[model samples]
Target: MPLLPGAEPYRHEGNEVGVLLCHGFTGSPQSMRPWGQYLAAQGLTVSVPLLPGHGTRWEDMQLTGWQDWYAEVDRKLTALTDRCERVFVCGLSMGGALALRLAAKHGEAVSGIAVVNPANKMHGIAVNALPVARHLIRTTKGVAGDIVKPGVKEVGYDRVPLHAADSLRRFLRLLDGELPQVTQPLLLMHSTVDHVVPPTDSARILGRVSSTDVREVLLEQSYHVATLDHDADRIFEESFAFFARLAPSVGKEGTATGG
Candidate 1:
């Protein structure tokens, strides 16, 4: 039988004040496992959902679109909000795009956002040149990079779906237009030497976001996947601190709240 809804091994639950972690494109919950583990240890409920067409086959990815991915995260975020007092979102790469969209559209419900190497634009001149290149670049081989774990080294889909890439481009365009709508505290962690998404993407985000409390941390030693790189610990430490500051304060009148 096919896996039931929310039956993936990645989902987990805990106390109130949930933290949702979204992994990058073609990546599974494994990419965010370390961060999720650390947060769960902190007594916060955590949910790391595998995006549609991922953690399975590359062809499956071609069959799916950005909407499918966003819908899945949306469901998890809604569930987290229903069960917790406040919700904070953290995402890596393409997942970061989804997280930003959530914050932009649901700013009233989100307490904070933590993004690692968010990809607001595709890298390389070819990506910019051929509007049809999105369909042409069908596969991206995983490299043995510093950011990937040994077992998870072969990251991303072997065959990148062109239609999906086009959909991603549309989403990025939408995010670019909606970024100023995000006014919550944001922590953007990006690697200076990232080989995938350009650092300029994060720089653009730092400049465009309307959030008054936006901070950027430069990971000098890592690559695109900062969440699993050598600087991953630092990402966790700083993110934990960011969320702590955003935690709702309890009033003397027996009410809990956050700004």
Candidate 2:
């Protein structure tokens, strides 16, 4: 699908330390561009690929599923990993799930992973309906831009695609089962008042992952799309600090020694 203007994929060349950012389901790379740029400004190589079914008309998304989405990110991440001596990943919502799965498959090859309001499991009985309802329903109200800060907006599909969401559930379940295999450092941040994905999903991930170094922070001022909300700067800075602790060389000027 052709990308909309201003919704194109973004890439910036920097040091051998690369950071791959993934946007959530139905969200275009626009949602993650700011974060990628922030990291790039810090002299880190960064890329945010528009997922297979995203950055175009909503109807176009109906033809794709989780595999297509994950493949795009996996390809970008592995490419970064192969080229860089150190690599980190960041994602929002379902993007977080993708990051976790990469950690499971790539192991310590991923230096660390940072995510905000990631969804692995949804709350309430509404989830049970996904199996049967996906066949009967085409779309539902989307969970996009669930930000508490007024006037802020997130770029995503207006309605949730049933088939794609169903595929996400299955993919998330698969990732959840493999969470124990994710031993890389993890930094998870969740909003206190998110209306889309609940806090339980974040808790569940912390409970399941075997990572020895784990940090969970509460975003008291923002909502689900905190990456674009009032606390956006905080998320970026904290994430940079998290990476700095692991890769101290990142903070110094001209740290790029080719891997």
Candidate 3:
């Protein structure tokens, strides 16, 4: 299939087990590319699809709705499943929310899920007031930490569209209701000092999901963007191990080589 507009599709051909990586809100595939590279090096097929309105100007993000974001990732997930024997999903921040939605709806198809700083809820009074004061508040983007790779920047839209924030709230509500349905193995990673998302968000997901094999990795050095922060290596290693354990094996020893 041809690549979608503003979407970058990375394909590594080797093992059948695949991992679909999703980046955070207002972030691009660059944020997740490091982890993708690590997993690919381990012989797993990895796909990091750029979310709609990302990897471009922030102004372009204003025109897109959450449905557009979800649709794009859904298409990528479908494509990965078609090519791999087993597929797992991992996401950061809002991307984590998207991953949860996918695992909830497609639990039978997904092998496992790994989430980093999943934004299950909006924290603090100012952010909580966004729904009512979103019109008055014109912008959502600001200079975040300088933890990105060289030449990569993370700037969001100048204004937080009231409609888009409203859509996100609705999606969270839907996800809250659907959490009990997710029974696949789930691995959640979050930082203790994440400024954008609260640790409670991870706790909520841990409490709600029906998955019996849920595990949480608390990152001490990173903030919200754990994928690019100090604990990034740990995230890659743990996620690789998680997926590898679930991958189908070919030998009598049951050791799968990739992903």
Candidate 4:
């Protein structure tokens, strides 16, 4: 399938310290490209994979589910583990939940984690209705492009595929039980005024995760798509610092150096 412009996956090979970034549900890699490029510029190997059923038309997304999305990120994490001495995982929105799942499932293999405006559960009647609604509805209004910065657009489907969204809800339910398994350092940043996800979701995650080293930052100026908002540079720089502090022999510039 021909991907939308700016929605293609991205990869950079720079050092043994790797960062794997996952984009949100109904979102393309374009949402994460700048963050990945920033990390890559700092001499970190970075991978931002377009999640399955994303980066294309909404109809294509209805054919896939959360398992497909999780599998792709898991595969990329394995690839990073194979090549990098230390690997960190980060994501935005639903991608943040994927990063948490990786840390839970892989344990010590993940050096750290960082996420922006992650969603742990769907809000309101939507969550309770998706199980049945998928059979009746095809799509709904999209939850993308929630940036506060003017003229900045998130490249994503204009509609949310019902089936895929239901699968995401199920994935989060399963992940909730696994939160205690996330023991690596975690840096979670959320937009204080996010319209897509409630702030309580991040609070729930912070309370449940077992990581002793965790930091939560509130993005005062951005919205749900903080990765592409006013606080974007803050997210990129802070996440890099979080990863570097946890990894051994990280240089002053945030790249890994031989001990």
**Top TM-score model:** 4
lDDT of 3: 0.77
Model 1 per-residue lDDT tens digits across residues 1-259: 2432322535556666788999887677777888988877666778998888876666777788889999999999999999888899989988898999999999789999999999897665555533566555765554223364354353445556666676777788888999999999999999988777888999899888999998889998778777777888999899988887888431123222222
Q: Alpha carbon lDDT of residue 115, candidate 4?
A: 91
Report how far off residue 121 is in candidate 1 (Å): 0.8
Instruction: Residues 35-102, candidate 4: write the lDDT tens digits.
Output: 99998887888999998888879999999988999999999999999999999999999999999999
Model 2: pairs clashing at backbone N, Cα or C within 3 Å: none
Per residue, candidate 2 scores C-alpha lDDT tens digits across 1-259 of 5677657899987887899999998887887888888988888889899898788877788789999998999999988988778999889999999999988898778999999998887556777789899899889888777877788688788888888888888898899899999899999999988887888999999999999999998999998888988888988998999998998888787774422
Evaluate model 4: give its lDDT. Answer: 0.91
lDDT tens readout by residue for model 3, 1-259: 3332434645566477778988877677767888988888877778888877665665566567779988988998998899888889989888999999899988788999999988886555565676677667545654244343344344333345555665676678788889998899999999998777889999999999999997889999877777887899999999987886777441224233553
Point out the worst 10-residue segment of candidate 3 by lDDT: 250-259
User: Which candidate gets the maximum lDDT versus the true structure?
Assistant: 4
What's the lDDT for all of these models? 0.78, 0.87, 0.77, 0.91
Error of 2 at 14 (Å): 0.5
Off by over 4 Å in 4: 252-259
By lDDT: ranked, best first: 4, 2, 1, 3
